[model samples]
Target chain A: AQSVTQLDSQVPVFEEAPVELRCNYSSSVSVYLFWYVQYPNQGLQLLLKYLSGSTLVESINGFEAEFNKSQTSFHLRKPSVHISDTAEYFCAVSRPGGYQKVTFGTGTKLQVIP
Target chain B: EAGVAQSPRYKIIEKRQSVAFWCNPISGHATLYWYQQILGQGPKLLIQFQNNGVVDDSQLPKDRFSAERLKGVDSTLKIQPAKLEDSAVYLCASSLVDSGHNEQFFGPGTRLTVL
Candidate 1:
């Protein structure tokens, strides 16, 4: 079994400010990490993923996350946030084997204010 | 390419009532999943299907919750004798195959309110 922990339930930041959402996971085997964003009344959208290599993965929307093995963390970061970036963020993980189930975190709500 | 589709964006029912939700995965997708998202919480996998066969359903409440994928294309989830605690958003997601590291596409979800 695997579990994901999102340290922050909510994070508020002024427009154009940088923000980071912390996530940690526990699993007995190797895993793949991912970040997903959900806007109001919409389904989840993939932000980025860390399958292997580089340890650091980036999304086209200025979001990035680093897979830290020793720390068991995959924290999401954005250098500068906009009002449009306000949404719920989720961290997910899956085991190394093929077709393994993915487990998600409690989620962090990012509120970008003016 | 069309995204995963689910019917009845919202549903309201009384306790002990029965309700059903439908889902259509993306064409050629080999894996489909049903998840429950409680308020202020992350989505929890309720059931998973590879084609028309069950892959994982360890978290599903077999007592009152049932789901099936027919012909390996469309799927349906049903809850009998719903309870107040059953109120949550039911989400359907599809992936190429649970292989490697493919990303799953999600539907808007069916928000079920049990009174």
Candidate 2:
């Protein structure tokens, strides 16, 4: 069984300020990590995922996340945030296999204040 | 390509009343999923389907909730005796494959409000 924990429920930051959303997971086996974002009035979309090869993964947007195996963490980060960057971010985990089920965190609402 | 589609964006009904939501996955996708997202909580997987076949439904509340993917394309979820706690967003998603690395496309969830 795999579970995700996102410590922060909400985060408010000024425009152009750096931000990081913490995410930690518990699993008996190695798992894949993912970051999903949901804009207001929009459906959830996959921002980035960490399958293998690199511990660090980046989205098309400026956001990036690093998968730390030892720490069991996959924290999302952005050097600078824009107004449009304000959205709900979700951290998810799933085990690698034929039948995969993704488990998502409660989510962190990022409010980029201008 | 067209994204997933859901019907009845918002629905409100009294407790004990039945309600249903529909979903149409992206063309050619074989895997479909139903999730329930309560306010202030992340989406929880209710059931999963692979080409009209049931894959996982352990998390679903079998006593009141049921879902089906009849044609390997469209799916429907229903709550026979909806409770107040059932007031949440029902999300439908589909993926190209049933792999951990596959990306699932989500639809604009159907928000159910129980009065």
Candidate 3:
């Protein structure tokens, strides 16, 4: 069994400011990590994923996350944020194989203030 | 091309009532999943299907919940006697296959409110 823990329940960042949403996981076996975003009234969308590759993974929208095996963490970060970046973010963990279900954290609400 | 599709964007019912949600996955997707998203909580997997066969359903409340994916393309989740705690958003997601490289795409979700 795997569980994800999101440190922050909500984050308020000024437009064009930097932000980071912390995520940690507990699992005995190897795992894959993912970040998903959900805008208001929308479904969850893939933001970025960390499989077996470099420690860092990035999304096209200027968001990135680093997989830290030692820390058991995969924190999502962005150098700058736009008003449109306001959304709920989730951190998930999945087994590194086929037909595995991803377990998600409670989620963090990012509020980009102008 | 198209993302996952779910029906009846919203449903309101009383306790002990029966409710069902429909979902149509993306074309050619071989994996489907049903999740429940409670307020202020993350989505929890209720059932997962791999081309009409059950892959994982350990978390599903089988005594009251049932789901099926006929033809492996579309799926339905039903609750025979809904409880107040069942009031949440029901989401459907699909992946080409549950491979390492593939990702799950989600639908808009059906918000169910039990009164």
Each prediction's whole-model lDDT (CA): 0.94, 0.96, 0.94
Ranking by lDDT: 2, 1, 3
Residue lDDT tens for model 3, B1-115: 8888999899999999999999999999999999999999999999999999999999999999999999888999999899999999999999888864468899999999999
Reported per model, the fraction of native interface contacts reproduced equals: 0.59, 0.85, 0.66
Native-referenced DockQ of model 1: 0.72
**Best DockQ among the predictions, by candidate number:** 2
Docking class of 3: medium
**Residue A95 accuracy (lDDT) in model 2:** 90
Candidate 2 regions off by >4 Å?
Answer: none
Alpha carbon lDDT at B8, candidate 1: 95
Top candidate when judged by TM-score against the true structure: 2
Instruction: Write down the DockQ of candidate 3.
Output: 0.74
Listed in order, the DockQ scores are 0.72, 0.89, 0.74
Pairs of residues at least 3 apart in sequence or in different chains that clash in candidate 2:
none
Of candidate 3 chain A, the 10-residue stretch with the lowest lDDT total is A95-104
Error of 3 at A20 (Å): 0.4
lDDT of 1 by residue, A44-106 (tens): 988899988999999998999999999999999999999999999999998777768899999
Q: After superposition, how far is residue A105 of candidate 1 from its true place, in Å?
A: 0.3
Q: Per-prediction TM-score, please?
A: 0.98, 0.99, 0.98
Question: TM-score (chain B) for model 2?
Answer: 0.99
